[model samples]
Target: MGVLSAEGVLLRRSATDKDDALVQCAEALVALGAVGDDYLTAMRERESQISTFLGEGVAIPHGTHAALGGIRRAAIAFLQFPEGVDWDGQDVRVCIPIASRTDEHVDILSALATTLSDPAAAAALREAEDVDAVLALMAP
Candidate 1:
């Protein structure tokens, strides 16, 4: 429904989609005060269902259950790796965790996925040193 708080942005020096991804996602959600221990556990369990992948060097590992009273306020998680994570046998680096009940979230992710695929956007995201810089490229 709304963009996550600035605190929700997690700038990962290294992106990971395995068990390590959970920690980074949880950190960002916790910083926003949108996630708790219960939500974290649910998210971890949901990962076993299926792997969230976006072709062209991007994958999103998300939790389906939800946080913020099970309403799914936690919309996304950002975990970027300098090297990359092996996803579905493909090497991926940028990770964005997503959970939402609103259409905006889908739109945003679509835009990001498109951007990540674009040569210019991908280059910029790859070079970014911090979340502020990365957000700038995605910002309108």
Candidate 2:
């Protein structure tokens, strides 16, 4: 299996706040066996230092370099919130939680950034209804 699998993609989800979304992201990463339990704190610390909210209703939440030791493997989780979560001041429709070894983190972010830079692609991801549709959109 690759970094992203059908099991990692969740659709039609909702969050009351940004922290709620982040908690779910951490849980998903844990459930996927990608990161240690403490990764949630790292995620929160990352968010505190810098907002993860990318443009076009998408947010990529991940741990900071210090937490890289907690990652068991490279993996990504997709959570869709149709109603949108307020991330600081930005409205986020999708939360993409990433777990990666230290060396692979930049590369994964680069590829995902390339794919999401496209307006249509980002929009498609936010509105994707099925697992296959999301998997296809997120393919690197």
Shift of residue 82 alpha carbon in model 1, Å: 0.8
**Residue 32 error for model 1, in Å?**
1.3
* Pairs in steric clash, model 2: none
Candidate 1 local Cα displacement, residue 22, angstroms: 2.1
What is the model-wide C-alpha lDDT for candidate 2?
Answer: 0.88
Provide the TM-score for each candidate, comma-separated.
0.75, 0.92
lDDT value for model 1? 0.62
lDDT by residue for model 1 (33-95), tens:
555645666667676677666666666655564443553364565666768776668776666
State the displacement of the C-alpha of residue 36, model 1, in Å, after optimal TM-score superposition: 2.0
